[model samples]
Each structure stands twice: as structure tokens, then as C-alpha cells.
Target: MSSRSMLLALAAVLLQTPALTQAFQDDLLQQCGTTTVFSNHRQGRLRQSGVSRVVGGIPSPEGSSPWMVSLQLLHPGMGYVGHICGGVLIHQSWVVTAAHCIKNEKYALPISHLWSVQFGPELKRFAIKEIVIHEMFAGYNHDIALVQLSNPAPYVPVCLPKSGQGFQGIRCVASGWSTTSAAPTTLTRRMGIPGPRAHVHLSVVSSSVCRNRYLSAYNITLNAGHLCAAGKGLLTSGTCLGDSGGPLQCNMADGRWYLAGITAFGSGCGRPGYPDVYTRLAYYLPWIKVQIKKHESAEKSGNYL
Candidate 1:
């Protein structure tokens, strides 16, 4: 069969299968087993080993951001698995990410099309139980989604902000396996060999400043749901390709890291003056709580579909 035809056939198969009843789902969960208990904070006894920080950014010490996760998909015809985006483990079974990460513009694929959520120091893979995309998401505006894992993994979830909390001007960190080089060849190689994740320090830019900058350049005003940040002048420090859906986390006064934003879009990776934009978590807190509650209610009633 032709390559295009083959892809069509595979996508058909993926779409036809029930997301919650794939044959490998049970086996994959069983094989993974219950290895570690989930928590919002890392235990002192747990070993810290695999963390690394991002583009034009410094290398973070290993295992620093335990909530970081790589969302991937398998391309059978291409003979490779691809890391399409990054996400955060928000709960034992729930993950938060950019809605665009899971939506295919060319084709409306099923949730089962997602290969797995690779996380932890060893980057173990886990099957997704369900996917919930924000109903109001349009392009990059409200670009957040949630994924429920078939089984919980051994990792710490990131702390979420309470309603009405704000994070303006706060220094935060964004980490992901995004490519550092702008060259095409480097991008391809980086995607294949996704090395240690990298992180960078960024200061939150107020909505007025961000809106003014974008309005002046792209004739687009920043929305209320968006948050912006950048590194020190012309330093070229920020997220790049493959970093979408990753968390922009801030350390609170209480000593716990709370997710401040979700990497959404930017003019270019680490480009001076074009600060990175994220979907502000504060604006979507109520929506998130509702989705979690709805999912929990469905699960309790054995209607998890």
C-alpha cells in the first residue's frame, strides 16, 4: 500500500477502537504495576537523579521537577515514536497539558492515538485512561487539557493555585525537552534523541506589558487567560519547539512548587523582545476543578467513558 494509504488505514484503526478498551491497555497497566505512591511533594528519602534544565537556559540538577512529563505518539509507518509535547502530572491519574497537543488539525484522532505519558527519573510510560479538552479552547487562547492515566505512576504532582491567586512579576522556571538549536537538522535529531530536559529562569511579565508588546508587533492583544515572561534582555532564554504544554512553575512561600502557567506559544524560541506566552493557570482554575469533579463523578458511577 502507498504511504498515504497506510497512514489512513492506521488512523482508521485507531479511530474505530474504543479508547478505554484497547487490547494492550490492561497488559500495559499490569506490566507497569503499582511501583510508587503519588504525592504532591517529594519525599526526602526519594533519590533525586534525572532532572536537567532548557534552551539558552542552564542545566537543572537531576530529578528536580518530578511533575514533568513527555506526551508522545507512535507512528507505526514512520517506524518511530515521537515526543510531541510536554505536560505536568497534576494528580495521581490526571495530567495537565495544552489542548492543541492532543488535537490534530488535519484529522480528528481518538484519545487512544496517544502512545503514553513518559515520566519520572527513568521516564516510565503509562497508558492514558481518558482525555478532557477544554470546551472553550480555540487556537492558543484557552489551550489546556487533562489526561487521566490508566494507572498512577510513581512521581510527585505539582501544586495548583487556589482560586483568585495571582503570579505577576514572580520568578519562575519552565522546563522541557525542547530543542536548543534552530537548525532543521538539529531539530530532527533532538526530536529523535530527546536528551535531558532543560530549564530556564523567567520573570513574569504583566498582561499590560505583554499586550502592548504583541499589539504593537502582531496587531494582536493579549487575552485575559494568557501570561507572559522573559529572561534578562537579549539573553535568549525561554521555551522552544516541543515545549508546549509544559509547566511554568513557581516556588511558593510555603515551600511547595505551584503551577503558574502552561506553555502555549511564542514568536520564536528564546528570541529577545518576543517573550514566551503561557496559558495562565489562575484564569482556568474553576474550569479545571469542574472537570476533575465531573471525571471523578463519572468514575464513581462506573461511567468512565
Candidate 2:
């Protein structure tokens, strides 16, 4: 079969399989609260070894471009552990990701280690000067954060949608190596170890539908600043355990990619009914700007306080 035909056939198989959706969702949702999504090891006592940060490295884009980018975080002793989180390269040195993915922690590593940035789906390394979390995002209200690399990425990063722009029912793809494991059968504090296979999938969902389902649970009030997307069918295919901090990118009429959301939470990976939730990046631009300014000021003064 031709490559195009092969891709179509594969997509058909993916959209038709409820089990695949369930598997994807289960992995991503299982990752919440298990330390930052960038950290590769499972929750519990932090591991001295293993890929420690982010979900997994970015995979190659097969077509024009996959609507996803890579995220890497600092891990102690392990060097920089890469994971898949959805993000848009907004500027030369800055990219946006979910605050929950790297929030609360002032440094990417534990203040005792170094962190680096890797861009595109290829997992190349770059030096990251600092990570700036939205000041207003104390817990979850505004769950967006930014990473400023020491240099620009080689690949063209996606840009943020203009303020007030909106999208629905767009064919979007988020790529990441998701953990392949279900939540422990029982409700216990401990979680199962996610398998090593890195995974990625495609889905198309509406903003209103996602808001109606997730707003109450995540405590978000959608507005011009917030953009949303979701998957349809009996099961929604999405980013899973290793897919946190990734982007939900949608295409626009002008043919440029616009970042619509950042993976935040979901009722589960691909439950038949529940929709995945993401932190609305545009909603918290003011906070993001403030953070950038703070970092700049600190740099100018030679102090980070």
C-alpha cells in the first residue's frame, strides 16, 4: 500500500478501537500527582536510576509535521530525562507547558542538579536558562508554565493562537511515549509501573464539550483566553502517563499551527465517556508575562529572588 493509504488505514484502526483509547487514557491519567510529568520514574520513593524527567523523547513526525513537540526536565543523578508533553515553541527560547507538569518546584532538578531543554520530536539537547511558572498558578487555578532555553530550537516550533481565536472539531495529533499500564485495580496510594513502550495517537474533540465536562472538576471557567479540544467515539484517544506537559495543537485556516491547550488532567486516559482536560495557556498570559519579567529582572540584577 502507498504510504498515504497506509496512514489512512492505520488511523482507521486507531479510531475504531475502544481498547486503544482506554489504554491511552489510562496511562496519561495515571500520571497525575506522581511528581511532575517530566519526571520519568513512578511515584513513591524517587528512584536513584531510570529515565527521571518528562514522559519520553519525541518521535519523528511522519507527515508535514506532527502537531506536537517534546518536553525535557532535570532529573537528579539521571541527567536530563525526556518525556512527551504538548507544547508550542512561542519564542526563540521559550515554550509553554502545563504548570502542574513543572509547578511548585522552583528548579527543574532538585536545586542540586542541572536541567536542559530538548526540542522537536527528535530529542536534541539545548541549555535551559530557567523555567518560569505562572505566579497565579498556586495550585491548579492557572496551570501554565514556560521554559526558556539558552538558545533557539532547530525545528520551527508551533506558535500560540492569537488572543480570542477559537477552534473546534479540528483533526489534531498529540505525540508522546505514554506509559502503558492501567491504574492499580484497587484504589491504593501506590501505582503500577508503566511499561517501556512509548506511544502516540490522534483525536478530534470540541472545546465546549471538554469545558462542559472538565471545568467543574478542574475548576476552570472558560473564556477568550482558554482553548480546548477533545476526542470522539466510544473511547477518546489521548496522551497518557508519559504524555503530560504535552500540547494539544490545532491547525488553522492560514496553514500555521496554533497551540490550543496543554495537557493537565483527565478523568482517565480513554474512558468511553470522560474527556481529557488541559491547562488553557492563553488564559494566563498576563501571569506568564509577569513571570518572564521577574526572571529578566533577576537576571539583570544577578539574583533570582
Error of 1 at 8 (Å): 21
Q: Ten consecutive residues with minimal summed lDDT in candidate 2?
A: 40-49
The reply for model 1, stretches above 4 Å from the true place, is 1-54, 76-80, 104-107, 178-193, 233-237, 240-242
TM-scores of all predicted structures: 0.75, 0.59
RMSD of 2: 15.6
What pairs collide in candidate 1? 50-63, 51-62, 51-63, 53-60, 53-198, 53-199, 54-198, 54-199
User: Candidate 2 lDDT, tens digit per residue, 1-85?
Assistant: 4434633443343234222243453443333112112212222100101322223323322432332444544345543334424
Looking at model 1, report the run of 10 residues with the lowest lDDT sum: 42-51
lDDT of each: 0.66, 0.47
